[model samples]
Target: MNQKLLMAIYFYPRGGSSQVVRYLYQRLEKKWSSALYSGSLGNKGLLTNAETFYRPLNVKSLDYTTAHTAWQKGTNPFDTENPMQASLEDRINVPDTLMARLSPEQLAKQIQSWRHLFSKELLEPALAHLHHLTPMHNAVYELWKKTKIITHLHGTELKMIEYIRSNPKLPFGDWWIEKMIENANMSNLIITVSPHDRDLALELLSVPKHKVITIPNGVDIEIFKPTTLPDKVKMSYWKHWLVTDPQGWKPNHNPGTIRYTENDLKEFYNDDGSCAPILLFVGRFTTFKRINVLLDAYSIFKSHSKQNAPLIIWGGFPGEWEGEHPYEFARKRSIDGVFFSGWRGHDDLPLGLTSSNIFVAPSVREPFGQTYLEAMACALPVIATSTGGPASFINTEPGKKTGWLVNPDDPYSLANALQEAVEDQNLRETAGQNARDYIERMYSWDNIAEQFTSTYQYVLSHK
Candidate 1:
């Protein structure tokens, strides 16, 4: 008989954590009898359809819960009195907050530690805001019925501020150690994408060393391939002459003409395009993603380089928070030779990767970075931080291994590594090949599926 496995995770699939979960689901479908996926697309970001990944395992329907919307009527899995819906004061679903599940004293002590943040001024407003964002109980309850719940933790840096406020004098205050610990303790199968995460989990969360599973993120190697178009994808004057009034760029300028297609990239010619190496940075524009650090590193690289100044391609989502993100810097500072393609889906990812010489993932607090693997799958060498998940599996041996792993916060270090990767074509090619080989051997979905299949069997057999 097929083993029943229930997975629970918050957030949409488009996010880093869910993306890993999605990968696992794809790999381990046959071994598990049933699977459950959860979360909302409205505020949780883009989520893939359940049918796309879960239906083959005989999953009935994805149990969805939104913090912004009301939950539909249901039998409830948590078996709580407050079912159909819940106000912020009525329920708290986060596993970390489930410490409220403890004795009143435990809950009180946890709250007392945060009594400062809730002082006469901030507490009421924060509560008001939180209450306003409270999700429905029916949604949470339905999620509890799943056989295996898989939640990928994204936005660790953003989440750190609140964690610090709650437990200030806590050890490793600068890092999200406690949060990692909480997840490591709570998750039946805590799969971290990075080795740093695995290390931090063991150190801070008090989880047994064996409980934490390290499954680095991956790329679809079959798709993304290298290209040899010297003049096809050059930056044109039209891209630089953008009209920015918040209404966005003007449409009459042959918007389609500016859009680069595979055919266009393959055939387009450039008068001055003498093939400057193209370097790419892909992922969200956030403090944790460290777009600013990347820009600074690029600037540093440019200053140091004497010849063949590399062209930089910055892709992915815009910053949701305030302040000037990389895209803003690229647009405002008129940073020449840099192109911003905003965000592109997986369908277009391969083409984009093929167009670049190297990929840089400079995230300050990435929970799991799949972009590096995707770049490698495309046969492009990656330069990433030795933090978060992507760095966990990276085997950087200069020109001998996958990619270069440098310190994230140090822009100078990043610049040095980036400079080397961009300048040496042979090193880039060899590292890229090694990266593809590593992903095929360890990070690919096939191996991940087998590991997950065993994990599911273990969880089911014991439970």
Candidate 2:
């Protein structure tokens, strides 16, 4: 019989972790049977539709909406009230007013309360189903107990709990820390996406090194490769994205709140009617992403550089960002040739990267810069920070430069790198080819799947 692996994650298929899970599930199915246990917020849009995205993989969505509603009405999960209701509010939609007013302590307590109820109502059922599959014989039960349960950590959860633990002033800090530690210890093998995250896991959760595995996220090279679209077709793609499917948003606004005009198209195209050298930034507008720093660098580069290359901002999930908004900073500085494409699904990212000239994201201490790989796979030269996973792959040598790697949080360094990338087309193309070659050899999902298979084999055999 094939080994059964259960992958449990709190959120539905939306973020980087879900993407990693989806790829791994596809690859792992060749050797082992697996199931996905995840919490659904009930949106099920193009982005959140795991059933379609992870097609053929057995996916069990623990609907948070139904569970939360049950908690609110004091209805037990065991009691029959059609407990897994299909239509309900998304659990992520906490009222803005309530969120803004909660103190750190109050917020932590509220989250802990929700997490407790969610575990009982959602997680327990999923785990119970797996348990039911095991035979009750003592030897078989012991062997089943040895079944490797891989808990994948994507840095955010580790950082949040660590922050609370280190800062004693936060309410329920100890409680949250203890809970996190318990969860970490429960896992047979803990997988972290980057070395930075593995280090954080060791420091924050006190997990033994033997139990932890560092596996960098992989890209689907087949999907994120350079496309051979005709110039006219490329122009149509630009029109469809910038004009037809506008996703740019304003501060505290819903997606599609900000849009572009036909005049905006001129900013992205050259006088010869071809797309200009587009510098792309893809990721959330979180503080650590240092989007303001990128803007500052772009502003400086634009002042001195002759190239009218546009910097296209490709992502910022609706109403979710920290520090100054990129649009606000751009407007304040009067930065030109800066376009926001808003939040888009991963399926649309390949075209976005293929159409762009450079991939730039100066995120500090990023767990693993998956976008960098995607951009590289799409044959775009990258500009990344020195402190994160990008450093592991991006070649920044003097002559054989695959991309530019600048100091974290330094606007001038990033500006110089951006200027260099914009000025030299030969360097961009040469480095882009190198980037594509490197991804094909090292970071493709096929290779990454093999790595996971090896890790899983080791974990299972030892257990």
Best by TM-score: 2
Write the residue-wise lDDT of candidate 1 on 1-463 in tens digits: 3344444443333445545555565555455443443433332223244444333433222223332233223333223221112111111322222221233333233233223222222111100100001121112222333333333334352244344546666444433334334434554555555677666555545667667666555555565555554443433321322112111111122122223333323212223645556677776544567777777777788788754444444443322322454545755665544545544445656666676678887876566677777787777888888876765667744445778888868889998997898778898888888877777766667766676566556655554
In candidate 1, stretches whose alpha carbon ends up further than 4 angstroms from where it belongs are 42-187, 225-274, 306-319, 331-334, 396-399
Per-prediction TM-score, please? 0.66, 0.83
Worst 10 contiguous positions by lDDT, candidate 1: 125-134
Each prediction's whole-model lDDT (CA): 0.50, 0.70
Model 2 TM: 0.83
Taking every candidate in turn, the Cα RMSD to the unseen true structure, in Å, is 10.9, 6.5
Error of 1 at 409 (Å): 2.7
- Which of the numbered candidates is closest to the native, going by highest lDDT? 2
lDDT of 2: 0.70
